[model samples]
Target chain A: DTAVSQTPKYLVTQMGNDKSIKCEQNLGHDTMYWYKQDSKKFLKIMFSYNNKELIINETVPNRFSPKSPDKAHLNLHINSLELGDSAVYFCASSQRSAAEAFFGQGTRLTVV
Target chain B: QQPVQSPQAVILREGEDAVINCSSSKALYSVHWYRQKHGEAPVFLMILLKGGEQKGHEKISASFNEKKQQSSLYLTASQLSYSGTYFCGTVRQAGTALIFGKGTTLSVSS
Candidate 1:
């Protein structure tokens, strides 16, 4: 079984459209994160939830909202996607107080 | 804040060795190393905590220097499978999110 999994491995949407990506982890971890990797491969943390509570939220736009229904799931919803929104999004999970994290395969989002 | 990685790219022949360094401007509580291949997720390689600590897994090893706020990943006996982009993540404090570096690309060829 995959430890961390996200739906819609590939997504292509038109500008001004709204889309969502779902993520789930069975590692029984306390923390789950969303990271965005650009074409240059620079990984940046977007949001993080610990035990279903928002912990760290970077300087992302309000159009991006993260909802964690439970400890095992973290979903990202983007509103009015822009051309610059095209990038690969990754879901990651890690145990509390641990330094290492496990990442999902990634969801490639392309906005026209 | 993102950590800085030296030698943005490197190429080595099989059996050769290479070292990738990561430095942080802020004090770091821990440093983690991960490798990602094309079209694949980043795989955890190792983590180092505390000053003067060294850890290794397989032929890959890493060292942490708290004083300089730096970490170095040593890839010994390079293999073709080792060709990938290596990233260093820094933890400023416990229970915080990881801040990753720009990444160092390593290509090992025969």
Candidate 2:
């Protein structure tokens, strides 16, 4: 079974559009995180949820929001997507006791 | 904060040794190392926690210097398959999010 999976491996939409990316993990993890990898290959954490509680919220714009429906799923929704938002979005999960994270294949969202 | 990685790119021959370093401005509780191939997601290498920290799964070795706010990954007897982009992630405290470096690209030639 897949440890972690993300929907719409590739997404393309125009600016000002709204889009959502869904993620689910088979592993019984208590924490889930959202990371953005820029074109330069630099990765940064956007938001983190542990046991459905917000733990970390970086300097991400208000246009981006993350929601955890349950411990196994975390979804990211972007309002009025901008060109700068075009990057690979990765959803990761890990146990509260473990420092290592298991990442999804990644969703490449291209704002055209 | 973002960790800084030195030697943006490196070329090494098989059986040789190479070192990848990661430094943070803030004190760290642990450091995580991972390698990513050209088009694949990163694979975990090892984790170094605080002082007296050193871990390795294979010929790859890593050390964390809490006081110095730095960590280094050493690959001894490098193999051809050891070629990939190495990244260092720093965790300032327990349950904190990881801040990654720009990544160091290593190319091991035959």
- TM per prediction: 0.98, 0.96
Please write out the lDDT profile of model 1 over residues A1-112, one tens digit for every residue: 9999999999999999999999999999999999999999999999988888887889999999999888899999999999999999999999964557999999999999
Give lDDT tens digits, candidate 2, residues A6-110. Answer: 998999999999999999998999989898988888888899889989888999999999989999999999999999999999898888524788889899999
User: Which portions of model 2 miss their true places by more than 4 Å?
Assistant: none
lDDT tens digits, residue span B1-110, model 1: 88999999999999999999999999989999999999999999998986769999999999999999999999999999999999999988888888899999999989
Report the lDDT tens digits of candidate 2 across residue range B2-77: 8999989989999999999899899888889989887667787888888758888789999888888989999999
Worst 10 residues of 1 chain B by lDDT: B47-56
Off by over 4 Å in 1: none
Cα deviation of A36, candidate 1, in Å: 0.4
Candidate 1 global Cα RMSD: 0.8
Give the clashing residue pairs of candidate 1, or none: none
lDDT of 2 at A51: 91
Give the lowest summed-lDDT range of ten residues in model 1 chain A.
A93-102
Highest TM-score among the candidates is held by which one?
Answer: 1
Given the true complex, what DockQ would model 1 score?
A: 0.76
